[model samples]
Target: MKKIFLALLLGSPLLNFAQNKLSGVVTDSVNKPLKGVSVFLPDIHKSAVTDETGAYVLQNLPSGTVKIAFSFVGYDTDNRSIPINPGENVLDIQLQPSEFKMDEVVVSTVFNKLQSQNVMKVDHANVRQLQHKGAVTLIDGVATMPGVSQISTGTSIGKPVIRGLSGNRVLVYSQGVRLENQQFGDEHGLGLNDSGVESVEVIKGPASLLYGSDALGGVLYFNPEKFAPAQTVMADFGQKVFSNTSGSNTTLGLKTSTENLKFLVRGNYTTHSDYAVPDGDRVTNTRYNEQDFKTGIGFSNANYSGVLRYNFNALNLGIPENGISEQTHSKTPDYPRQRVYNHLLSLNNSVFLGNSKLDLDLGYIANTRSEFEETATPNLKMQLNTVNYDAKFHLPKFGRWESIVGIQGMHQSNTNKAEEFLIPDAATDDFGIFGTANYEWKSDVLQAGLRYDNRRISSEAHGIAGVEGSFKSMARSFDSFNASVGYKKNLGKPVTIRLNVASGFRAPNLAELASNGVHEGTNRYEIGDPDLKTEQNLQTDLNLEYKNDHFEFFVNGFYNFVNHYIYTAPTAAQIDDHDVLRYVQDDAALYGGEAGLHIHPHPLDWLHYETSFEMVNGKRKDGDYLPLIPANNWNNTLRAEFSLKNFTDGYASLNVSHTFGQPHVGAFETESGGYTLVNLGFGGNVKLGKAAFNVSLNGNNILGETYIAHLSRLKTDGIPNIGRNIILGVHFNL
Candidate 1:
């Protein structure tokens, strides 16, 4: 035994010499550090976790060609193969976010299996994309995606509708957890930050297989950066000033990693006064401010990995309105509202089970909102808390098919209190089981999935005795099923084709189906219908894409059939003799298509120009056109980049877009004028030894025009749109 032990110790050096140490950092689209990222080798059976600084170090790595996999709980999983040389191997990796769970992929279950191009993976917006554009909200960054449209300002209050579906039918995931705010309200902000987002992905069709309820439209996913592996510390800071709103913003980020653990932390703060029209006239009290924070940590080894993360954000809004009495002046703060805070905490683990992969995630989310009105003295408050857990297994092999199975469960509770309960306290439990399978060849692929969801809800005052304290609790149950199949083929030429057919469904929100009261925030009376059934949607889409060296284009068309659609319909009866609108259910049909073309005429590296256009039209099955949908739109952009010696990288860009507004009848038959906006930006970067300093100047609505976008909700309160704005920003990296 002693001789065997000595021989093992002596031969360990040979094993160590056969392995290589690899270390590096990962960042977001904004170049901010990320943490709690998972890095592993499937063929070699080795893995490591990133530290808080978005850094990872894998020891005992075999040399020669090896396959490496990278994944974060909230983001997409990425794989690549590289040849390891002698001594040390250093590589820096940047990971993007994902919409579907990994278990949804067949390749995840089979080792040494090759993935087809048809594996509808999530797409990420990289640094090149964000640095090339200036946006006001998250919608501005993702609205251009295939099958995605914004019906509101397309800025601050925008929500993405997938394949003619919107509102509560869609689910939004941040860092791998659902955000439970007033998602049913159009004016509700998504409460996210573009500064910290590594990237975003939109899942186009039915996703009930993994997400359970409230995913009929699809999912919007955001992933932050992971920790670095190099025992080194990095910091970045920047400030931006907007010309239109005279608004200023700032962000600070930091990352660091040690031998065993890693950490990444970032914070952002922004404040803006009322913006002006292109005419330089103040747009009154349409001012808002926001704050956001995020942090993550991870620990990992060969067989097991664990991660933890935390996030918090808040939005404060002040809207302008014309007052009836002298005491309430035009700038007297007609609308003072606050979505005080949204908080999230998460923990995840992945354990290797022979050839199978076992993963689990547990999370908790808290959302709080409050409103104070000038017309009423009391303050209204609503709070929601949710607990979620998920577990899944990736099966090794099944003939020529790969498969996965998973279980998910969530518990939610909400409470609202005020002078009168507009929305009352409610409790709900949701559980689901799902599976997916995929088969593929070199250029042809086929995939299918199915999901079953069950929900139980309990609410007070439903079929109860009285309105006062005599309320009795009522319990109800709901179930929904989702199924989808997709086919794809890639010709050796420059064109690729994909066709998909899917069915999705959404149950009415607890508040929309059971609440009966008055909301003080918007001064509106709301009534619910208990007889409403689950809303169902059937969608079919075809996509043709062409790609080459200098030009790429895509054309996609879709048709949708919906049942029991929910909408805010006008009612002849008044609450206190004041005109109002109530929630109602009706059948509807929607059809539309979005297409884009890109051309780079100049072959020279110094100059390049790109142009694209998008158009959409939709009408209800009843022939009542849907309200708030935008008309045809198009944008043209031109840019030039110059490399000066070895020290400077300079670029200048200009953009112009036209938006047409067709007539739509809202609660009051409101009509908006069509408008056009132009934007211009110029910037350059200089390398200072190992550090860099970058500066940019941008102008929005350069014409200073006074046209309101089709999505502006300001028409409801008699406020005119703002004009052109300017911004100056500076960036530093080390």
Candidate 2:
């Protein structure tokens, strides 16, 4: 009896392991085997490619219900859920030809669902697409999206503006963790490198229920590049060059994977001289250089998966003061420059238990910034350190309902390392808990969530108590409850509508609550309001989409109402030879929308035409326009795709963009004139003997338009944007 019991226990392990196996074959509509098809399991971070026989296999998969995705170029993707028992399972997929954009699974949202199945509308774009558009920087690519813009200081420093909001209202995430890099100042840019990044997902509305504070506007989530397939090794190299800035970018990467372990590493270097204007003169002190490195390691078993990632970035950026003056193309930056460094580390883990799963993510970030004015020593320096954590438990599915409960928190500290201080030393702590659920019935879906958050901040006094630049020791606590609800319905086979209502809140930052010194970036003396109230907003969004064989159309509209909207205004006062500005609050409203359409003629399947328009308006209750509002813009593009004798995926495109004049100016602001620009692009993949490579050429502002953007920070200094730039890029697989 004892021997039988022991044998039963030991044999049970082998039986369960045998059941955790999945194999599949992929075929096209004509029953022809399809090679190079991607079979991925996102939950476990496992992927495989179909062989010439269209056969693929994955071993040691978690038991119970799991989701699988099968995808290929020029074909419709298949996403389905399957159940596994104590035996091998096989799933064969048949794909159909598709002319429209392929559907992708989004991870930024609460539930990992395909774009076509999500209750809320989310925009997704890959890095490769942005590169093809001739984007010189990461933010440049992001700004090209509808309803998005950038506040630019030069070609190298830019801050993303979503809809009509900027600064702390927007949240950024990378490597499944929140990015904390002292983003309270307008001079601060997104401290991220484009290399090693796979794609970006934009949530256009309030997302406080998913993120805690500082998400009153929206979220930008970046997905990292995936590891190589099981038992495979891969390497790649790429280079890009720019004419206007005399810039170059170089990148190299290597990756390898086994059945249960994966490792990858990447390095990038970029350098650029001062950017030139239409007059062919370079902007003084605008040169910059950067170095970045990223690495990751991942391991998985039948019931658990874990991944660890690290990134390091260093930058030296010259602060542009005077307009175009120098004609030299030197790579070294002049004085009055900035030095910044960022280090990020994150770990993500998932445990599958029965029919439920638990996910935990932890992250740490350290950021250091320094500014130089006249001497070799730094004039202003600060260091920020942050640690954050998140945990979620996915409840077992019941009928058509799925739910999740999660908790998130962060601890941060800031210290001054220079003699001059703009804000006092501070420490902040945050905590939040939330619950969300999703329900699906036929073609209708509903999603809702509620969350509660609390933040506590404490600061130490600095300088003389009664001095003009003095600060008093203080402590403050802010608390709020937020919620979101969204619904999606299919009106017909080719039409869909979605509506969402969400509320978000933001706790004032240390700079907004304690600043009492000169802001060199803005050339103004700023004072903070210690008694400021928390800013809260409620937003409503509506979307309508229509698609068929040869046409696609989409329109989105939103209205946002805020209580205690904060802004800075000049006062009838001056200090230290600079005008004085004080932070204030008032009730405000903003309304805007984006609409676009795509057409592919029936017989001319290789030809495509696209157009889009975006606009936004913001006003206070006292009938005054808000500052930094973007101008209305329209964009049109014509593109053609073909395959040459030795080249594949050959394409050419022409784009025209028009910006309308901004007559509605805020107090103490000037209006901007309208402008138009033209751009051209072409690219192709070439096969030479046994080697394959991709080549692209792009020309931006081909007409040399000499105009300033409405959101350009240099507009106050009468500096026009860059013009007549050409880009050449090449990539090779080794």
lDDT of each: 0.65, 0.89
Least accurate 10 contiguous residues by lDDT in model 2: 5-14
Task: Candidate 1: list runs displaced more than 4 Å.
Answer: 1-57, 60-116, 119-123, 144-156, 323-335, 375-378, 397-400, 462-473, 518-524, 580-582, 646-649, 664-669, 688-691
Query: What TM-score should be assigned to candidate 1?
Result: 0.82
* Tens digit of per-residue lDDT, candidate 2, span 1-734: 23532342233332433337889889999989999999988877889999999999988888777778888888878887777655588899999888877788888987888888898889999988888899999989988899888888888888888888888989999999999988888778899999999999999878999998998989999999999989999999999999999999999999999887889999999999999889887888889999999999887766777778899999999888866776678888788888999999888777778689888888889999888887779888999999999999999999999999999999999999998786788999999999999999999999999999999999999999756668998799999999999999999989999999999999998888988988767768888988888999999999999988899999999999989999888899888788989999999999999999999999999999999999999998888999888899999999999999889999999999999999887865789999999999999999999989999999999999999998887888888899899999999988
What's each prediction's TM-score? 0.82, 0.97
* Residue-level error in angstroms, candidate 1, position 315: 2.4
Candidate 2, position 96, lDDT? 87
Q: Give the per-residue lDDT digits (tens) of candidate 1, residues 89-149.
A: 9888876643222311222221233222544433345422554466656676676554566
Best by TM-score: 2
